[model samples]
Each structure stands twice: as structure tokens, then as C-alpha cells.
Target: MAATACGTGSGPGGRADGRTERVTSLTALDYYTDTTEHAHWGELLTGCGEKAGVAVEHRSVPAPSLVPTALRQASAGTLPDLLMLDNPDLQQFARSGVLAPLRAYGVRTDGFGAGILSAGTYRGEVYGLAPTVNTLALFYDKRALAEAGVPVPRTWDELRKAARATTRPGRYGLAVDADASFEATFQFLPFLWSNGGDERRLDDPRAVEALGLWTGLVRDGSVSRSVLTWNQADVHEQFLGGRAAMMVNGPWRIPALDAAEDLDWGVVPLPVPRAGDALVTPLGGEVWTVPRNDSEARRRKAAEVLACLNGPASMLALADWHHTVPSRPDVAGRY
Candidate 1:
């Protein structure tokens, strides 16, 4: 067999072969195409792998085909050695046994962010790791707001009023994406969260209340009706084109916004609902994971790599590169 160094004691060095034993070759996936834009994920994963003293080979599977293909591959005994799994898919895989439980690998409550950890846990078993963290926030055009003599809004009612105040014939107060992709959750979930509603209870009165707020904005002309057909990129385009006064998005868009010289914008936490406490939004991001190895020693080494990646400096650097918040409170403050 072709042997290479596995980071833990179970590999080549632990045996007669002078060559380090190779851990299982890793096949990675991201929900992104546009290789130019997505190569960064490969870089980040590789960087972590290098730091952890292992070679992690990556491959990008189309986001749309990811789940079905993963299921098919698992059935064929050809599942990838590692997966960069999304949060929503985590539970189903865990229940079906497509994912191996991660708790024994040292992904426990203390080290990982609870909010993120909970997203991938089912029936008390953690199934995935998060490499990125996200929260919905307000993106406003500083120049436009200044010109309009409007202040940054701290509450939903104030934001609605601001949206109405800023709207003109060719422009809109707020821009939203209602598409079925994850982006739709980004635009609408925070409003639900701010109002103390949730995705799990879409039939709740609060849920209906939240949806009403969205429809009300469109009804009252604060948001453009055309926005129902838009996507995340569309919202960004409108913001950059100066056709929308404000948008709700995660920090991933910060890099693009930073590069747009003509756009003078600032970010703030999402506004609170009139009926509730301050806004609390859904958390999202990626988690790095090593496939469960057949040998116990390889598993130990994989755990070490996880520890290194979650270290303070690496966490901060990854957070900065990804343009998302760090899970660690200490790491977050350094930004």
C-alpha cells in the first residue's frame, strides 16, 4: 500500500515502514462554484491541514448535487474521506448514519461555540464542525443616509420609518432576497428572530406576525415588490448601484463592499423588533472535520489538527480571511 505520514501514532512511523502512513485521502465540498471565488476555501482547508501536519486533498462537488451525490457515494462505499458539510444537512445525515458522531473526536461544548455546535447536533450527538461563523447585520450607505438626513436605526419601527423616508420613485428603502436558497434565510430569519419567532415553528402566531411584517413592508411601499424575485447578489447589486438604502446580510459581503470605492457604507447589528428584546439572529459558518479513521491512532492525530485550527491565532486569522465573526470571544475582539 502507498504509505505516507498520518499525523497521529497509527501511521507509518508507528510501524515498520519508514514512509509515514497516509491517512485516508480527503474529498472536500463547498456549495460554491465560480472557482475564482471559491479557491479560497481550498486554501483555508489546506492551510489548516498543513498546520495540523497532514495532507488534505480537496475536491469541490457542485452545491446543488452535494447531498444526493453524498448519499449515493456513501451507498457505493465511496464516500469522501472528509466533508465540509452545511448545518441544515447535518441533522438528517446524523440520523441516517451517513455522518459519524463527532463528540469522541473532541468536538464538545467547551471548545466549540454553542450556537454553532447546536446547529449540527441531533438527539445529543454532534455530527459536524464549523469553520466559519455568521450573523445577520445591517448594511447602510453612509453617504446616502447623510444626504437623506437619516440616522442609523436601532429598532424595527425606526428602520421601517427610515425605509419609507428614504424611498423614491427609482429607489427603495430596503432590499431583500426571498429566493429559496440559504440567502432567503439570511434576509428573513433575522426579522423573525428579532420578533422572537423561529424557522421550526412557521405556524406560530409569532411566525405569522413576522411574515406579516415582511408583507407589510412591501404593502406599505417601504420595500420594492420586485425584491420577492431577487437573490443575495441582487441585493448587493442594488446597494452598490445606490438603488436601495439598506440591506441585511452577513459579513461575507464585507470584502466586496470594502472594495467598492464609490460606496460609502457601514455595518451594524440587526434592528430589534418593537415587541421584543434586542435582536438575536441565526449563526452560520463552516466547520473543519476529519473523516473517522479505521485506526484509533489516526483519529487522535485528527483531533490534534482540530485543536490547532481552533487555536486563538488561527481562529482570528481564519475569521479575518473569511470576513465572518470568530467563534471565540477573545479572537473576535482582535478584529
Candidate 2:
């Protein structure tokens, strides 16, 4: 699929139920509190609104508060016209009946990655669609790694060796966010999943091996002890401040990485358990969903806005602005 292959309108608009009245504005909700993302998303949404011929009123909350805030809205029967849910929480909202399945509203989903589809699914129904998605990669400071004669690490042993060999008086060779939060699990997934560890079988030997590998890096002083207090953004800071030769981060940090005029960085797939194994990192992004609305006309209008938002041009625009991949595989090639 390609950008040109994306949809152009709400397919076969039979639901213009003649009662659309005069909705001057519709509300939208998301967790993009960062200024860049907030402004960019507002621009994108406003553009989509214009294309759909509706005035879009945007609202946002911190990511941690989204679900609770949504629940409050749900209780008040006042969910936004268009709601953006982080992929993981899509199932929760769908299961709770706050989210209406997109298929019923004619949103496209046939060309997205399976991981993305899985995240937005609830009991076999697609409840949301993200225009773009992101995942972790091993980001190395090119100059630092080259100076230390460390080529990009490709496997567990190689990464360990490179990390240890590159550590110096003030810098650790590698950095990771080992904070005791969901981010820790997200950051650890590549190691565990790349090693064929199963999420369902947490005590499996493969899981233990991955955990042991991380512990080994810490023991050898190749990974900083401060990792316990860090998050993904913190890892980016370590890489930017020259405190770490390499770190695992997502493409969303590309803008931040581009800020330091002297920072020379390169990215590669996260290292695996063995030379031939594929890296398996967690897929991440927010999905757009139409909340259960009071009227058919409102739902139809919201779906039209959604149709525009997920179209190729919008997806590509968003992906480029944020340094993320378009959710539509066809459109993603443009990135």
C-alpha cells in the first residue's frame, strides 16, 4: 500500500441522517502535553476538521491521567467527539463500552502492522486507528562509538563487550531506563522478546536470561546505576550530554537528538540474543476513536473527521513532524 492508496472520504455516506443540525464545534482529547506535539497535533486536527467541514475543539491531559479523566467524562456522559487513546488503553475503553468500534463507522484498518492492530482491538473488533506508530532502536553516538572502536552491537554478547570496552571515567558505554514503571517493562521488552521470551511465561528461562543480561551490564559498570531513576527521555539526555555512548530510544526523540549541533548519532535495530535473531521491541502510539455519541449525525460527522485524519497525507504529515512511522504500511513508506 502507498500514500496514494489511502481513503479520500467517509465511504458511502448514507448516514447523513438529515438531523446533523448545526454542530459549530466538536471536542477532541489526547495526551500530547509536550508543546511541539501539542501544537503539531492541533494543526493536524484543525486541518482535518477543515477538510471534514467541522470546527474542532481540542483538549489534552497528561498521559497518566487520560484514562481517569476519560472515566470522569464517561460518568458525566460527556466524552469528547473524537478521543485519542494510547494503543494499550484502547482495549480498556472498548471493553468498558466508552469506545465505539471503528468498523461500524467505516474506518480503514486492513494495512496496519499486526502489533498495532492487536493493540487497538477488543474481542475481534477494531476500536481505534493510529495515524502513526513508534518503537525502540539502539541509538549510538557515532563519534563516541567510533572513537572507542565499537561498531554497532548486534547481539547480547556483542553489546555487553562493546559497552564494557567503551566505558570511561565519566561516561558509561550504554544506558537504559530501568525505572520501576511501565516504561521499565517497555524498555525491557526488546531484550526479553528478542530472546524468545513469552510475556505469559514471565518465569521462563528465556526471560531469566534476558534479565540476567541486563544485570551483567550493571555489574560490570557498563550500564549506569542511575538507570533506576531514568526514563526514555532521561536516556536521551544521557546520550545528548555525553554520559552514555549508546541508549535505546524511539524515533520520537529525533527532534531532541537534532537539537545538539555537535551530536553525531546513528540508529540500528536493537541487539538480539544471537547474531541471526530479529529484534522485537514494543510497538507504541495513540489511536483515534469515535466515542459513543448521543446522535447518529454526530457520530457520522466525527467519523468523517477521522477518515481525513487517517488519510495518507495526514498520516505522512504527522509521521514526518514527529519522526514516527505512519500507521498505514503503504503510507509509512513515505517516511
Among all candidates shown, the one with the greatest lDDT? 2
Q: 31 in model 1: Cα distance from truth in Å?
A: 2.0
Native-referenced Cα lDDT, model 2: 0.82
> Which lDDT tens digits does candidate 1 get at residues 1-335?
11122222123224244445545333455555535336665565566566555665556665556678777776775665566666777776677675656668665445566787687678987666665588778899887677778888888788888888888888888888876666687678888877878789999888888888778889999788888778777888888788999987777778788889898899888888774577777777755554553444455555555555556766676677658777766567777
RMSD (CA, Å), each prediction = 4.9, 5.2
Clashes of each: 12, 1
Off by over 4 Å in 2: 1-20, 110-115
- What does the lDDT read for residue 291 in candidate 1? 50
Looking at candidate 1, the ten consecutive residues that score lowest on lDDT are 1-10
Error of 2 at 313 (Å): 0.6
TM of each candidate vs. truth: 0.79, 0.87
- Identify the runs in model 1 with alpha carbons over 4 angstroms from their true place: 1-21, 32-37, 51-55, 61-65, 103-110, 198-200, 290-308, 333-335
How do the residues 255-281 of candidate 2 rate in per-residue lDDT, one tens digit apiece? 878988989989998999998988788
